[model samples]
Target: MKKRTDQFYLVREDMLSEAMLKTIKAKMLLENGKFNKINEVVKEVDLSRSAFYKYKDGIFPFHTMVKEKIITLSIHLEDRSGALSKLLSLIAQTGANVLTINQTIPLQGRATITLSIETAAMTADVTVLLGKIEELDAVVKVELIGSGA
Candidate 1:
């Protein structure tokens, strides 16, 4: 007998096949009330019903995974003046409420910050926010440590 276990990956959109991408589009059309029927959604996105069904249960947009949930992030940052303030400001711009924040004392010009945030009111996808954070000059690294209710 063989056992099967589910696995997941965070793949970039461009890496997905055309059919998989179209499947995502079809699913979105149905979700946003733009189309009620799967047939309509498949036609709108130029994907066949079979292809849509094949990938529908497998592919999902990144935002859907974190919506209405609380997530924890571990950030490594340079100990530059106002770096922490700037980071918090960026997070606020995304509409994610900061539930709690803990910071380690700067050692050798670097610090670690752990943040718990509520994503229910976020204005954009969590991945977008993380990308923006990664672009910051003072940020060393950002990791999604955990997520839950």
Candidate 2:
């Protein structure tokens, strides 16, 4: 038998089944207080109560996955204009939200940058994102500083 692991797989919205999507919508309605009862939520979302119950504890909205995850990265960058801008733009394109940024003065044509990102809405996993970041011409190195659950 294959070993079992405790991990959640992140899937694109388009890949979700219609019933699963409805369950998410119903849960959202209830969580946001738009509906006071499960029946009302199910009716509005076009989901059956049985289906909602089945998926309610198994699935979560995208933001819920990263609500407590914060990844810090230490990057060495070349000292030049548009370097940081390009980096930030790439990150944005990947759907990661930048939580904080710290930079030290450049010396020897290299600068150190530390950035914390919330990966809840990120399009890719940390490893993949870091690889993409390191591919930038301005980036000398990218290291994962830390991650918190």
Candidate 3:
């Protein structure tokens, strides 16, 4: 048997229980400054305090999950002149701050590059950025390797 400690899922809003949905609304109210206290938010959202507390730290909007975090990407590129420079320039255009970059020595005209970037200031969605990267002529593949604070 396997133990599940850290698992994530993407569920439709309609599939959630009323309490869970209310908890989400309550949290949003607090975050948006509409309510100063948890009590106020719970009241506005019609959720019980205990139920709000139960799901507060467990659920988050999708954008909230990825915003203001660092993401690592693994990219396969053709070892051609200026390919790396163009790639970095494209990433810069998205307003993402590059934290670190690692590249393997070119082997058989191909190289793998790993990049860690801060997404807090990004102007584009991560998915959009990945799509743009994939369309680049010299890029063979791009994979979201990991993300963290």
Candidate 4:
């Protein structure tokens, strides 16, 4: 097996208050689609209903903030009808709002398209979205040209 360079560090378990632990559990429950109603979440996590309400709006998973940034993608695709349309549809499905799109004329059956997109509402990580784009039959190459908040 290959050595794993990415590892997770654990914080002292005792450092967290019972309320905090419950809140974390409640959030996880919500993310996993195991629970939706606040009452259900509070009960599942063993948290007082009031405590759950107090902290729920203030806490969020790390990826929530990361997804708020805007990024520009440069894609080289096979010059074929519906190729661009399919790519745009994939972006919409990923919840990325397109800010700008520039496509160069086809040359030797390939074209370069650049898209600047707001990722705030994206349901998945940028890498995952890029991977999906790469898997499309019409896409020849994809690159992240830049990103910003």
Candidate 5:
């Protein structure tokens, strides 16, 4: 047996500077397909291209790893024929396994769907999967909410 001890650290979200926030926003825009090119992402986020280059590798979201393995995704999708079907098809094509799925009633013109998936056999990297999901016409927004393997 080994002794155990509790450890903790405090972080203040408000203490983050504007540049850090802009860097994170730029990365999110790229992740969400709101901006395709790096220049466009940096420009839209009002950060210089040099700043983007400088901070991008180190400015990933706190939940980025949640997008990499077993993942919980929240999707806002148009309530239309074959929308969910097509989304699932893409996931299958990527060799990801669906662990669970839940959807809310269509409100207005869209529905909120939560899917938990395992990526043990994912055909490519998570970034590729994210790009594919973002390309789906019926998908309005896709967020990585949580993950557990």
Candidate 6:
């Protein structure tokens, strides 16, 4: 049996057809609380109600595109002077906001650091980011403990 899968595409706003753009605008109007009724919003945007209904649930504003995602990582680092600082700098460069950090005291020249990071604005895939961090000199191990989106 063939599996049914949902697919998404990122198209530039200007590339969309006029009717599609109008549909998006109509949705925005209702979402912003500027208009109470669907007919008023559809009329203002010059789109038909049938078209609005066709795309309403399928479209959303670009700014609201990324859903909330969080990743929790467990990293083992060499107990060096600047290991933590270097790790944090790399995360910042990728736009992954560090939400919380907990580090255990070094035992036998190694420490376990737990980091919870928000990935909504991350520039690279989470796995790529983790792999990059893992390649650093002071990093002994990197394990993904949990994630939510």
Tell me the TM-score of each prediction against the true structure.
0.91, 0.56, 0.62, 0.57, 0.57, 0.55
Which runs of model 6 end up more than 4 angstroms from their true locations? 1-68
Give each prediction's root-mean-square deviation over alpha carbons: 1.8, 7.3, 4.8, 9.7, 10.8, 8.8
Among the numbered candidates, top TM-score falls to 1
Error of 3 at 77 (Å): 0.5
User: What is the model-wide C-alpha lDDT for candidate 5?
Assistant: 0.83
How many clashes (backbone atoms < 3 Å, residues ≥3 apart in a chain or on different chains) does model 5 have? 0
lDDT of 3 by residue, 29-104 (tens): 8888999999888988888999999998888876676665799999999999999999999999999888999999
Please, what are the lDDT tens digits per residue for candidate 5 over residues 80-134?
9999999999999999999899999999999999999998788777668778999
Compose the digit string of candidate 2's lDDT tens values, residues 1-149.
97856687879999999999999888878888999999888889888889999888888875565455688889999999999999999889989889999999999999999999988787776767888999999999998767786
TM-score attained by model 3: 0.62
Better of 3 and 4 by lDDT: 3
Clashes of each: 0, 0, 0, 0, 0, 0
| Residue ranges of candidate 4 with Cα displaced over 4 Å | 1-68
lDDT of 4: 0.85
Error of 3 at 24 (Å): 11
Cα lDDT over the full model 6: 0.86
Each model's lDDT comes to 0.90, 0.87, 0.90, 0.85, 0.83, 0.86
Stronger candidate by lDDT (4 vs 6): 6
Q: Which residue pairs come into collision in candidate 3?
A: none
Question: How well does model 3 score by local distance difference test?
Answer: 0.90
